[model samples]
Target: MAASALISPAIHAVRSASAIVCKEVIDSHVLRIDGYSRLKHMMHGKYIRSGDFHAGGHAWRLLYYPNGSQLQFQDHIAVYLQLASRDPNDEQVLARPRFSLLDQLGNPALPHDCGMHRFSY
Candidate 1:
């Protein structure tokens, strides 16, 4: 089966679960890593967090790992999306946003829909 065919259900599920309306399949914001070789060496064994970027009307950032954080994923790189800004009173602040890694050719390196959570806030 094609990648798009495989990911359609996941996207639909995220929309239904989070009530998140996306104008596009993936969000427009892209995080590019240029000098990864030197960066990882400089900040050894520590996570690199990006500056705040807007997504779903809230601030979000990419937490990157040059070296994996745990033993299980030590040989592989890991990245996480963190909710950078929040309001206790905001209902739509915490959302189940999908994350994906795109190759240099713009193909998704992994499955598109990686997260599906029901946020109480």
Candidate 2:
């Protein structure tokens, strides 16, 4: 939902007769909009990409998933925040913080919220 919140306007959620169809159109667009050309203009060196990890994170970029995608997204979003936090940038542009498997443990994982700390299970 956090990721969708950021992508909604830029990419409308298309609905179709079949879930497969909707996923085809909507999901592909997510990947395309995130392609190199778009990334060059939109993301630059900033943008952190974390997702619902209450169960250790799922690689659900709408529909696409790959190895380490979860961690990759986290690192990406963090980079953006790190840069924007120090410079004049739009904080609202942030990817609303969401839960991750990283935090679905004994204690809450406030990595960024608390200097992005790490803990062992």
Candidate number with greatest lDDT:
1
Task: For residues 2-90, write the lDDT of model 1, one tens digit per residue.
Answer: 55644553444434344667553335567788897777666556788888897666677878888777767655667777777766767
Cα lDDT listed for each candidate:
0.68, 0.31
TM-score of each: 0.62, 0.18
Model 2 ranges with Cα > 4 A deviation: 1-33, 56-117
Give one digit per residue, the lDDT tens place, for model 2 in 1-121.
3554445546679877845442211111111223634444454444435332221121222222222135555333222211112223332222333332243344534433323322211
lDDT of 1 at 62: 79
In candidate 1, which residue ranges exceed 4 Å CA deviation? 1-26, 118-121
* Predicted structure 2: clash tally: 16
Q: How many residue pairs clash in all the candidates, one count each?
A: 0, 16
RMSD of each: 19.3, 25.0
lDDT for model 1 comes to 0.68
